[model samples]
Target: MDYLMCHIEKEFFGTTFEGIPIYQYTLVNKNGAMVKIITYGAIVRELWVPGRSGTLFDVVLGFDSLQEYEEKNASYFFGAIVGRYANRIAGGSFKIDGVTYQLALNDGDRPNALHGGVKGFYTRVFKAIPMKTPKGPSLVLKYLSHDGEEGYPGNLDVTVIYTLTNENELKIEYRATTDKPTVVNLTHHSYFNLSGDGTILDHEIMINADHYTPVDENLIPTGEISSVEGTPYDLRSFKRLEDAIEPLKDTPTRGFDINYVLNGKDGELKLAAVLKSKKTSVRMEVYTTEPGLQFYTGNFLDVKGKGGKYYSPYSGLCLEAQHFPDSPNHSNFPSTILRPGEEYRQITVYKFSMEG
Candidate 1:
């Protein structure tokens, strides 16, 4: 198949250390929007979208080769799917039906678990199937997590679909089922810089959240659901990212790394955030079915990205939509527990456009 103009194209990416063959799927839309997804980690390797000048620019930050991901993704996450649980779990421990499960202490200070312990969905090679749909091109990725893997219960079968629609929307749908009770909070970890280069401090942003979860020094939720009023976390209206970060200069959160309680029902998709870059005039609107959105600025980034470009702190930002962190321990938070015969589902869309 001639892939130059094809809506969907698949090619061999690379082989994993386990001798597993991985493939990359490229999905192109009628609007010149394109997305490259790889079976390894079910990651979005690149995203090219039209800007105000009608030029397509790759807007996400990632590496050029599979080896780079294999070596660097453990710290960066990049555009991979983070799963089982997305954020920090207090003391790397949680209880299910009065039984405590201990996970790896992989986060800061070695007191909490981050993104499903040492091995997460981000490290797995998903089985990929590329197909054409009426809406556009879609790639389905599936992975199975065995019981006791990463100290989590049950054999969980997870399926994630990445669809590039005609409207320039990168849609992600996640579904899972477990044989026994388990807690799950999956989210996509994509660091986006709409301008294609430089720090993301100038990006204009807006989040549809009235309250946010307060966190401690460990970045674990303190069980307080506080209002965003009179706080830098308030982004109910459009505000420049630099301005948003200014108020937190002297605070523990030098930059945003907190979860916002989104203003919408939990089960239905709704607008979560909007980000725009004046340099490129590209606008990205995020919609999700989850009740919480983790807005994190790349505060510790200091690495070379694709094309050997040096990425400094705040080079990109991540808006992770998922259930609240440490949900299993917080009785007041939304439940993330999945039981036998029950299904876990979530959808998040990153829709793009250009402003003249």
Candidate 2:
């Protein structure tokens, strides 16, 4: 909690509707690594690291102004924490022990509730506090989702910790407790362009999953776990996103927006994916304790981002770590229900480096 020793700084970010103040906090490690987070939605505004040539540059895509983030178009989740249910829920309804709870259908014509029924955690303000660990400088953000906040059950208290380690790892830890039975899945939404401001099509990517959940036309899982072999979904080995996306660009959805069943024990933090931008010589290794990772290419990403840069489709990508989408609707998938006493926890790490 010692700010001086941790080298954490705080400043004014902006104000919300009622003119309440919002703040931004910057964490710096001894190795010149930096991470910027804001109280609004506990969003990660910028993540900077050194490239192969030892020059620091921002790797995560976002906006310079909070207004741009607040009005981030229809597809702009932008480096914030998404929750309640991090992905899609079919028909916006789920039953728990014979009681059916209906949610809002927010995914356009899909007739599904997407990312916590619209006003998800990404749309709310979080109480942010700074603290440091032996591993690095950290920021802890807390939020209390009142009972029936988004047609979901129970009053949920959630905390998310973002740590910038000296080893160039951005570690995210999530914890939530509910008073009644409820479904909760949380993850970070960051459009990562390792080259910083260019199309991410050329990034070399590899995922450790051999199976994936196939979605219907509406992008809802058909409750089938299919093999990725011989398919463009097969990212078992390193493949250029340009090549992987080429075959699927014609699809109605336009690019890769699939969810991979992470290969490992449910709660063990294991390697999920590795991304390298040869253009910038910047590499990122993704590790997580969650069972599923949603790999979303910026297929519909048309919006103004930092420095007035216009981001287009395939400009950036997201590797969201959490439970599978619509877990409440599928009995076979890993359960996402959190009862009175059971707690929910997930950890994900994004380690950055250069070709060394």
lDDT of each: 0.92, 0.89
Model 1 misplaced stretches (Cα beyond 4 Å): 1-6
Pairs that collide, model 2: none
Best by lDDT: 1
* Model 1 accuracy (lDDT, Cα): 0.92
Error of 1 at 182 (Å): 0.4
Candidate 2 has a TM-score of: 0.97
In candidate 2, residue 34 scores what lDDT? 92
Segments in model 2 whose C-alpha atoms lie over 4 Å from true places: 1-6
Q: Candidate 1 lDDT, tens digit per residue, 205-264?
A: 999999999998888899999999999899999999999999886776679999999998
How many collisions per candidate?
A: 0, 0
